[model samples]
Target: MRILLTGGGTGGHTIPIVAVVQELRRQRKDLKLFWLGDDHPEERAAKENNIPFQKIACGKFRRYFSFWNLIDFFKIPAGIFQSFFLILGFKPHVVFSKGGYVSLPVIIAAWLLRKKIIVHESDAVPGLANRIAARLASKVLLGFNAHSAETLSAKSLRGKYIFTGNPVRREILKGDPVKAREFFHLSKEKPAILVMGGSQGARFINDLISRSLSKLSEYQIIHSTGVNNVSVIARSDCRERQSNLISTENHYRFCSYLDVAKMALAYVACDLVISRAGANTLAEIAARGLPSILIPLPSAASDHQFANAKIFEKRGASIVVEQKDLTSRKLVSLITSLLKNPNQLETMSKKAKNTITKGKYFLIKKLRISIFKIN
Candidate 1:
C-alpha cells in the first residue's frame, strides 16, 4: 500500500510519525512511503527512513487576534492548491496525518480525491489544525483516550475514534545503559539526569538549566538545549567550567538536539527526565518507564501541556510543575528529593510503564487492522 505521511512544525509532530512509519516498514517491506512537509526534521526523518519527501506550502491559524493570522489565511489556499496536485500525482492509498498546522492542506487534498485519511492527535486537548482535519478523517486515532468532550469538541466531527496510544519508535525502547555511559563519557560516580526542552529546545528551560547547572554539579546532566540555543548554552558552559564552578569536565553534556539513536542512549543513561510535557516525549518516557519532572509550556495553546502533565501526575509517574512555578532552585530540590526517595521513584517507574491506555495491541498492528481491515 502507498502511504503518504503529513505532519511537521516541531519534533512533537514529526517524531511520532517516524515511529508509526518505522513500525509499518517492519510489518510490510513493500509499502511505499512518502513524506510531505517543509521542515528540517520532517525532511531528515524521511531521508533517514529512505522515504521520498516533498516540501509543500503550509499555513497556521492563531487562536488569539494576530496580524500574522491574516497573512497566514492566504497561505492556506496556496497550500491547498499545491497539495491537491501532489496528492493527484502520488495516488496514495492512504494519508496518515500526525496533526500539525502543515497537514491541513494535505488532508483536504486527500479528501478531495476520495482517499482515506487517518489523523493521530497527540495532545489531550486537540489543536485547531487537527480539529479541522478530524472532520474529514476516516479514522481519528487518538494518542490519549478522550474522556472529555473538549478533546473532540466539535459536534460536526463524525469520524470513527480509536484510542491507540501514541507510538514510540521501537529503537527508543532498545537502549543499552552500558553503551550510553560509554557514548556519553559519563562518570560512573554520579547518576545522570536527562534535561530536554523537547525537539525544538526551550529557551525557558535552557535559561533555568544555565542558572542551575553550577548548583546541579551533584549529578550528571545531559541536556538537549535545542539546535538554535546551543551556542548560548555553550558559552555559558564554558564560563562555568572556566570559573571552576562545575567540578568535572563531564558534568554537563549538551547538544542542539538528539537524533533517534542518541536519544535512545540518553534515555537509558539517565535515571530521571526533566522535560516539557509534550505528549510525544511523554509517550517515550512512559514507554521507557522513566520517572520525570514535567515542566509544561506555559503558553501552550489551550493549556494542553499542563493537562498532559497532570495526567502523568495523577498516575504518580511524574510531577507537574507549571512554568510559572518552576525555578532553578525548585528544579534542583525536586531532583534531590527524588534521588532521596527511591521507593517513590520505583512506584512512579511502574506507573509510567503501564500508562499506556491501549496496552493490549501494538500500534502498527492496530493501524493495520483498523485501517487495512486485516483480520
Candidate 2:
C-alpha cells in the first residue's frame, strides 16, 4: 500500500505524524511511505526515518494581514500545481495530513485527484488548514475528547469525525527510572523535574528557568534547552552558577535534544514536567501519566496552545501558567509546592492517567481498513 503523509512548520505537527508513520510501518512492513512538506526540519526527520521525502511549494497561512501574506498568496497556486503533479506521479492510495500550512496544498491536490484523504487535528480547535481539509477528508480524527461539542461544530465537517487521541510514540511509555537517574547524574534524595521548550527550544522559558536556578536547588533538573539555546546556556554559565545551590554534585543536566530512548528515560525519571503547552508534548505527557505545569505560548496561532493547556488544567492533569503571567519566582514557588506535596502529586498523576485515551491503534486501524481498504 502506498501512503503519502504530509505536515510541517513545527515539531508540534511533524512529531505526531512521525509517531503515526512509525505505527504504520510496524503494522505493515510492505507499506510504501512518502512524505511531502515545504523545506523544513520535519522533512529531515522523515528522511532520517527512511521515508521518501519531497519538498513542495508551500505558503504560510496567517489569520491577520501581513506583508508576507501577499507573497504567500502567489505561492499557494504554485503549491497546488506542485502537489498535483507529485500526487499524480506517486499514485498514493491515501493521504494522511497532520494539519499544517504545508499540508493545505497537498490535501487540496489529493481532493482534486479523488484520493482518500484523512486528517488529524492535534489541538482542541481545528486550524485554518484542517478546517479547509476537513470538508474533503474521508475521516477527521481528533486528538481530544471525540464527544466535545466544540469539535462537533468544526466548519465544513461532515459525518466523518473520530476521536483518536493524538498519536503518541508507544516507546515513550516505557523507561528505566534507575537508568534515567544515573544517566542524568541525579540524586535519589531530590525530586527530579524535567524542563523543556519543545523540540526546537523556547528562549523565554530557558531564561526563566535560568533565573530560577538558585531557587530550584532542592530539586534535580533534567532540561532540554533546544539546540539553538545550548551555547547560550553554556556561555551564560547557568550551570556553573547554580552548582553551589545544589545539594549533590552535578544535580542538573542540560540536553540540546532528547532522542526517543533518552526521552523515555527522562519521563520515567522525572517527578514532574515543566514545559510549553503544545499538543504533541501534552499527548506524550498524558501517555506517560506525568503531571505537568504548562506555560502556553501566548502568540500561538489562535491561542491554541492556551486552549490545549486549559483542557489538561480542567482535567486536573496539569497546572496552566500563561506565558505572559509567568515569572521566575512564581515558577519556583509552584514547582516547590507541587514537589513537596506527594499526595497532591499522586492525585494529579492518577487524574493524568485517566485524562486521555491511548488509542493510536484505533486511528491506525481506520487508516488500514477504511483508507487503505486492507480489510
| Candidate number of the best lDDT | 1
**What would the per-residue lDDT of candidate 2 be over residues 158-277, giving only the tens digit for each residue?**
577776677777678777888888777777788999989987788888888877887777888888877665434444544344322222235667766777778888899999999998
CA deviation > 4 Å runs, candidate 1: 147-150, 153-159, 231-233, 236-250, 357-361
In candidate 2, list every pair of residues with a backbone clash.
none
lDDT of 1 at 137: 88
Q: Global lDDT for candidate 1?
A: 0.81
TM-score of 1: 0.91
- Poorest 10 consecutive residues by lDDT, candidate 2: 240-249
User: lDDT for every model?
Assistant: 0.81, 0.80
Which window of 10 residues has the lowest lDDT sum in candidate 1?
239-248
